[model samples]
Target: MSRILAFIFRRRGHGRGWHWTDIATWIWLIGGTILMFGPALWLVASSFKGPAQLAEFPPTLLPYVQQTAMVEGYDAPLPLYTTTQEDGSTKVLAEIRRIGVNSQMVDPGNPGERINVNIADRSPVREIGLATGNYVEPLVKNNFLRFLWNSVFVTVMATLITLFTNSMAAFALSKYRFRGRDGVMLLIVATLMVPLSVILVPLYSVVNAMGLLNSLWGVILPTVATPTGVFLLRQYMLTIPDELLEAARMDHASEWQIYWRIVLPLAAPALAVLAIFSVVWRWNDFLWPLIVLSQREHYTLQVGLNTYAGELNVQWHYILAMTVVTMIPVILVFLFLQRFITTGIAGAGIK
Candidate 1:
């Protein structure tokens, strides 16, 4: 036991060459990767499962495999009704008889009363299933595709608006010094500490007053200005040398030209990072979209997913598949912009 522990924890060779720490590090990495991605892989796989396969106590990972279950009331094969032949003759159709327990580990005591059945009459077995219809059924039955389109449009528009508004505010605060500038920034940043729940009623009233209820514009308009985005871009903008802006000014560059040509190009990294966050936020935004878009046809994907939830039994199969579908865009966005995330956040301090 002592040696085993030493092997796992202690250095193996001289001078830190291939120490146990390296092994431990690899082990940790592998374990963490599995822990993160295992459930995702499982959800994708489970979407393909048939009803019987899904209810298995310890669920199987691989789809499209035959499951030999020891069904209740069945020690031996039970006979199904006979099938008619071409000449109108009848033949007995029977289930496959098990000699002993099938899947003893899964069901040690699940077997039941023995009945006789013919081996020759048993039909050929089939795979578990792919169940592709789970994806299609939701789109067809609940107008899920429309909701997906709504989410895409809202998220895109809102993120674009957020980038423009936040970056403009940030550029002004960072580059152009003015009276009460610090006070204005402080006030805006302070809003970060205020909980959204506290202002929900007042904010909703304001939206309602604008006659924007039940519209996607209502959802997009409320979230266009994000404090975090402002702060991040402001800090990032501060890193830009004023000498460059001054040089451009000496060359007779207009304020708008300097902002458009100089500031925006340099701030692309921070914007990429902000875009990723904004997309994720608006994509998963359920509560606001639900409240604003009361009509079913105008629902976002997240809201439409709620259609799967019932008062009693939830549609786990469709939910699982749709959940996978929901995650794909976010994953793609992250994968595309992940290189900028660390640099953006690190350079653009939270303040």
Candidate 2:
């Protein structure tokens, strides 16, 4: 590990000694990494903490749980503490009960007699422990599997549909010359400025008219035709040479053949970028799913996780665990297709 670290930080391009700019660059990179990943690390740590540890005044990054010892006569385990005596000696004692400022403690070895110690003199014996129950209980009790299935279905189906529809729109706008072609592209781009909140009511009404409310398709259909996807694909498709389509036409190729065989394959990088965007959008979508799906069994993961929150109390542990789980798919998708992002975006605006 030391060798690997040394090699990674070795001065290859710089002179014999490290420069001030190199130091500043390393600092900036390290700071940016921590800044971006700090909250995610905190969430992972907090997900493993028990309720009592979570409620600590000065919260700890590591999950520390109070230790307990089973006394001889006691049916249940008692909390253990290290108490400081007047003689400046510390002894491990099991706390039986506490009354105001003083606690009744017994030596676990000899539990016959009780000793009174001031609460201030005793500190809890705690060790780093993970609360695995936070992750387990929700999966077992709640319909987590159903929610996962619904979310997966929505994300996959929505991404497929988004790619197909947006690519068709982009192909037409970029390749074909018609009287209202620019007008149509301008109209689609204009919709990007309209916030989702403005169309929710009418969109809801339209879905209801189609009898799609309370179904996964209702959530999937409304968001599949995104203006950003159309614009991105159209820009990328513009960079494709027109001579390719003309060559296909000269070879007795149909419009569908030109689109499927010639155009779609060439636009793969842009499609990958759109796929990533669609998956993330559909996976994390909450409002549309919440408004459409009324049944618990039909709920997506985002809406299902909301059920953990109540009017009075919120189940942070389960919520945090499930939230981490929800992020896994999106993370995997981004990591898989991330290589294409720069290529796609850079090519999209060219020509």
Candidate 3:
């Protein structure tokens, strides 16, 4: 009976241990979710607040308070008369002051009338109401739409060019065996070690000579050939079964046909992954675009966002609003494409 009791006690302890492990995993998941999403939640909440509520001490997260002040009636500047006191001192005053709903005139019989005044409803101060205009103003004032268009243009064109060139080079390195093929691959890979800054001056000179400075092409042309993209795609392509290519060749498929039909579709997942990276990189790119394009019209979203940071004073609220706006596109792209990345990596590995 003592032995039986001891075994039962041990089994109970093992059950508790498993229960604790399950609880730990749940806690970890909850904590990670909060850490990842807390700032974004705060930003979205803050975007709805009015300026005063946002600055309130002991800071209120919700915009529930509404305060209003009365000014002298609506004649331009609302006339305030000066009264000469007995000793030649003069006083100026607004006609009305309020405590609760009741309001009293400063001087019972002032000539000017009082009007209920409403301050322009500025952007949401606290985390309560939506201030649509705060988000809207930056887009209109800064030519954000044009900047967006330029960013899209550059990203798409550059990504397409990068994909085409890199894939072609990668296909050559992967499929063809010739004298010095391995040496050529090594040399191409070696270029990846060179820092982009080292070539900026020479690249700038080439763009300037071509008269492409300040042009979208200048931003697109230099990055059309990325060694990283080539290297990554080549590794992926090597995993493709040679038997498939040989079968296509037996059917009298040309090299281009084999690449177009057989290789490209099988390589879709890897290409999608590359495309997402290319788009995000080009979209967020600032320094290169700043160096290449001097014109404001050609500025990308990243460059345009910098205008909010002035030499003398930074408009923190406006800058924050614009920043929130700018992140939307990147977030959307990532959300849409993130599903492909893991699958692409797995597919590439299988090949």
Q: What does the lDDT come to for candidate 3? A: 0.71
> What's every prediction's RMSD, in angstroms?
9.4, 4.4, 9.5
- Pick by TM-score: which candidate is best? 2
User: lDDT of model 2 at residue 224?
Assistant: 85
Whose TM-score is higher: candidate 2's or candidate 3's?
Answer: 2
Q: Compared to the true structure, candidate 2 yields what TM-score? A: 0.77
* Candidate 1 per-residue C-alpha lDDT over 88-153 given as tens digits, one digit per residue, 9 for 90 to 100: 675433344355432111122333333343333333244656877778888778688888889999
Q: After superposition, how far is residue 317 of candidate 1 from its true place, in Å?
A: 1.8
**In model 1, which residue pairs have backbone atoms overlapping below 3 Å?**
none
What's the ranking of the predictions by lDDT, best on top?
Answer: 2, 1, 3
**Candidate 3 C-alpha lDDT tens digits along 89-190:** 754433344445433333324546543322221121112346556677767876777887998899999999989888888888998898999898889868
Candidate 2: where are CA atoms >4 Å away?
A: 1-31, 66-124, 306-310, 333-339, 342-351
- Residue-level lDDT of model 2, residues 1-351, one tens digit each, is 999977877788655787888789899999999998899889989999888778788989898788999999999999999999999999999999999999999999999999999999999999998888888888888888789999999999999999999999999989999999879978997887776788999999999999999999999998988988888888888899999999999999999999999999999978888888788888999988999999999999999988766425877888888888888986786678766665655755421
Candidate with maximal lDDT: 2
